[model samples]
Target: MKKQLGNNYYNIISEDLDGEIYDLLLTDVNAALFDYSDHHKSNKLPLKSKFKQFLINRLFVGFYLLNKLKKRYTGEMIILSNAYIPLNVPNSVTLLPPWIFSPKKKSFANWKIILIINQLKFILKERSIKLLLSENFKFLVDKFELELGNLFVKFKLSAVVVPNDMAFFEKLALRVAKKKDIPSFVCLHGLPARYNDIDDNRADYLIVWGKGIKELYIDAGVKEDKILTFKHPVYSSFSALELQSNLSNVLVLSRATCGIPCESSQLILTDRSTTLHYTELVKENLKKLGVNKATLRLHPSENEDFYLKNLPDDFFTIDRSSKDDALNQCSLVIGPTSTMVLDAIKMGKNYILFDPVFNGLTLEGMPLVSPFTGESFIKLSNSLEEMKYNINNPNDNISYHELNNFLSIDSNDEEKFLGIMNKNK
Candidate 1:
């Protein structure tokens, strides 16, 4: 069963641990995820590891850890992921990272530094059987280089390909896989964007959505023989159509732009959540200027007390987690970066992505960064008059041109992915 990887993080989470305490905490978490109603008592993990002896390692932790452990224990060995994973073992592998990715440069830098060191160690230590998991289902470009490096490495047929990522993450994975020299494949789930870069550096084989993705890869760079458009392992078929949308009708998406859930890195992004606060202020200013009746969707876990105490009664909040209600109701979606935007599109709703793109540290517990532009709505003034006018024409004020042909996949994603993987296999 899938589970959460709490306690492992010691920053904004908690620092309660000893030397071997990491495993202990993990056991506790796993037990909770597995529904610990009865079975208790465990000094060490019931299952042991191939190398670490303790069965768990910091390298593979979080939601990802559960899947790896499931594989080792021969317990259900099912794909436990936020996205699709490999159906088989050794030949198929997951490609997403075990930890949350930060958009901030400092996190990227630390990751780069640590990765470079790891690469150096891999070279020096000769631990070449490297398998990279799928994508983060959100940030497609976040770890492109790392995946590319993994694909480039020479090993025993390299790592197996698993269905990784859901939406954009899968798209990014496909692009990177396109770069690989080996026979590569990804099972279908949501049809992510087919990056032109992917076709240029196409994998030997691919599991794709349907004729559309197949045609896309062929256009991008994939040889016809390398591409396989699978009948979805999940859905039957799908179609895409654009919805007429407006801006004044606000799309309230979940955003954790507050400062409380801080990123672990102290170097930069220490105060990255200032944008959320700033956004709040900007909204207030807009309201004072006279614009009212915008949707304010709070992140699922966000504390509304501060905003409740400050903002006027005009503001209205809704459940961002409820995918159906928001898409079917709101006009234009707005937030830092969230899956809800994509979810909105899938539901035939228009959206405007708001991304501040922090330079330093990006906090944990925050949502993924939106892939859209920050200045898209700059022309709209904070004045009530401007907001009201903009609200009256949400589509006109914001850039809707960004949501073009690529992201409009209604349901044919799974087929596209599996087609590629099955062909490669």
Candidate 2:
């Protein structure tokens, strides 16, 4: 049977260390709201307004095409106006008919129609300017915050547990929780891109993956007491997987970008363009080592179609399978500074840390200095040849004890999480 927190606010999803029921006001970054509205579906907009909407959409598409053209030939467009043009209308406005703006059904009339049309014109103009300035998303952030605040009030939520406090919505939710005198907690899902990303003001409590992360937060100015070390729930199942000795099938994890560095002196950071470059290097090295079978696991944020089109088909198989399945099948896992490396460790797979940008450089302000310094289990490879050698000579140097220092593999993660929630309550 399901448990209840109060009348209708939240429900008791799980139990604590003392077998006590804990209420969770579950929430998420509502991504579905950002998806395009179904144009074919019937809506409250009048027939005339619908036609105007169609025209607006067409105009938006035309402007987008023009913008693409402008990007291609910036110098040649001397005759045309260089004013910014948005690629598309905001999903929030386009998803619904303008008639929906009417607070009362009877209030919808000519004035409302005029107002809606004017609003659309204004939005189009503003969006164009925002696009030009690369500030399109900044405008919507306020709307997201307002919506989140309203939801919290409507549900009479007691507390909020989010994955990352650094996210715009999560931070907003945390602020709302603070305003309401309710506790807010952020579970560290992955490593922060930079030290500055960790904001002490964002959450009341932080449930970290392990001691390593706890140390990172403390160093970033987050109070030591506010942070709690808990084993990552995802790693718990894979912790039982024994490390393979004879490494054969290799899995190369691809990242979308090497996040901005904390220090100015950190080697010139590379972008997504380096993805193919790194993958090709890995492919060449694998081929040289006589390891024909290898899979390239694209990051979740990466475009699968783009990689498939660009990457050599014969060199490596593009793995779109679940991470657990991929980890299970592969004997060796290789990647840069990614949370998946921790996952690979939990799965008892040998992983090689490869990052050309951070080579021979260390940032004192960052949690991951060189990726090589933190844990001895991770084999740091400077070049393709080095990586190939490491793979061929499969080292059994990294033990579970070393892995434990980074991640709490054997701990009851649920209990630890519950303890944090209970303590805050």
Candidate 3:
């Protein structure tokens, strides 16, 4: 579709799509949304006492609601609760109200009946609360789309750019863009990993970080023309950092408890326990290799208090610094399957893959499929003993040239992204 605004400009809409390329767009709209709290910090509590933790989570929710009410009544919040327009934004861009909830819209009785039936399916399940909230949020997002459609018509939006197509709002925005006859693209936020039953049919195009992700999407049945390769705007800045000489510290990146889907509930519990268990085992192996100076970097969604209280007191120090700093300081990095590994590769740092869930398992039964080809550059350790050997005898086989074949780590990220945006215009 051609530019409807009579200029080569785009309207970027997302909650977390902020950065250089997004900043380049003169017209942008953002939704102020809160992240869903991970209330079940089960890793910190005993298996039998998790029910009590759930009750504590309920109390936390009550307090959170009260805080929201205070923000609403006091006019301290913006977007949903309070009304305010940002002065820093350019006049061309239009920021919409927060799409959290619609108090004016009444709940449909038929929708409530459907939600109740869905809740009944998970009545006795452990993640029932998550299911209930997700269902209700989807209903609200549908209403939010109606409001957005009107805004798109009034503003004469040319195109829509989103961070990803995973969330309810992102998908809804894509639908609105389609109905209005505008191009919609979802930019790559992180390294794309293979998962079962993922739907990638929401957006008109996918903006990926490199050729590696492009190939992965193609393998997942996405059209080749719909996938575009562009260097990550943020990480491209790290290409200038010089590798330090004293790269001896080991950094262990921890994954979230419910990061992946399992075949059954038994597998879910086993996956969580085994991940935590193997992480501790990695620490012990590092100590045996005389690498006492190490750090454990928790996922943003992970509860730090849970790990600090539950894990061994003196096993490894927790590093809350930025990921780039941690990767630069650490000589060797290890993790199960994360985008951090790609960051390390881009920075010329050595890394080892230690996914206990799928390292030894067959491809058919693996919990998660790796995106990389697992070439000799990226070493794998099946057991603690193997991990120790890899740590002690480090290899310098992986080079930037080899990684470039997979990831397009070029410096002209801004130019490349704009080229794609203006292609249709």
Candidate 4:
């Protein structure tokens, strides 16, 4: 049987812990655990090296921040730093420091000892799980559980809202809030890319951008009642499509090159080599279509300096402005399956989902769903030839009215979000 790491990890912990701890705490850890096991084709990193990473990545600054900022906010709604709650809700206090900054502690010696003991127990009981418990992973579990539990008590927060349940402190906050009888929610910040039980929602309610995402989650096994659709606050303000005279400059959205380990699944989605290869293909194909120059808009997470130095060719100009500004300048947009496609269409710009087939399948290695899948509504290109075809035929794409069901253009999102949040509060 394929190991359902999240379920398995939870079952084992619930059997031993004997507490009111909700299952959400372990969700993020197991998600990363599954990805980690699939990533390391070779030997595991040494214990010393693992500890160093744990300190650098999780503890050093994080520990200090947690203690320093514990008294900073005492409100009804506690927002985790990574939550990205776009709306300006009342009685909300956002933690400034990220979860990577560890809570202040005299020494990690006791936690390290507890981790070793747990590792030995895992080795004897379940060898498969033992492989998942690296020094860093174990430290994260113990450290966050204790620190976040304390933070919840300190704030006396009645409601918790987060962007996702997949991040360590985010899931931990949900779990901790549940134990304290405080309602928790996930206010989706962007278009969801994956739909599966592995990416299950831990929050009581998942506040989505539209019915499109809500339906996708229901199909993926999430309960319908647990989902509440709210139009994106930003997308609601989308300007009416301005008629353009000609297809001037084309804008290409370039996402960061991330490995399988960085994601929640074992799927071979993107790699450094494949990403660079795809870029080369885009530049070459655009040249074939008589387009000498196009703007390459990098993902927000990407560093401009790094991409400038590493990009295959200087044939393209880098886009540094906001998404709205960039889309306004460009007459035509081409890129992979992303939320940016929605933005491009909202601005009256014709967009082509450039999902070129790499090895008999799309670069994602699987078929995507809805906004990315519905070729009848949106233009999708599986090959370079198709990309050229879609660009030439700009009229063959989803209309402005057709996009309403996905993201409503009405200004009632603020009211909807407030209604749901008030009920929970």
Which numbered prediction scores highest in TM-score against the true structure? 4
User: If ranked by TM-score, best first, what sequence of candidates would result?
Assistant: 4, 3, 2, 1
Name the top lDDT candidate: 4
Off by over 4 Å in 1: 1-249, 257-276, 301-314, 318-321, 356-371, 374-425
What is the per-residue lDDT of model 1 for residues 258-281, given as tens digits with 9 covering 90 to 100? Answer: 221121112111232452454565
Question: What is the Å distance of residue 390 in model 2 from its true position?
Answer: 4.0
**10 residues in a row with least lDDT, candidate 1:** 260-269
Error of 4 at 189 (Å): 1.6
Give lDDT tens digits, candidate 4, residues 29-88: 343444333123212455776687656644444455445545554335654444454557
Better of 1 and 4 by TM-score: 4
Candidate 3 lDDT score at position 137: 40
Question: RMSD in angstroms, all models?
Answer: 15.5, 18.4, 13.3, 7.7
As a TM-score, model 4 comes out at: 0.68
True-vs-predicted CA distance for residue 275, candidate 3, Å: 4.0
Query: Which of the two, 2 or 3, has more lDDT?
Result: 3
Off by over 4 Å in 3: 1-142, 195-197, 234-248, 259-271, 345-348, 357-373, 383-397, 409-425
TM-score of each: 0.38, 0.57, 0.60, 0.68
**Candidates 2 and 3, the one with greater TM-score:** 3
Compared with the true structure, what per-residue lDDT tens digits does model 2 show for residues 188-251? Answer: 5565545432343367776666666666666766787677665544542234345553447788
Residue pairs clashing in model 2 are none
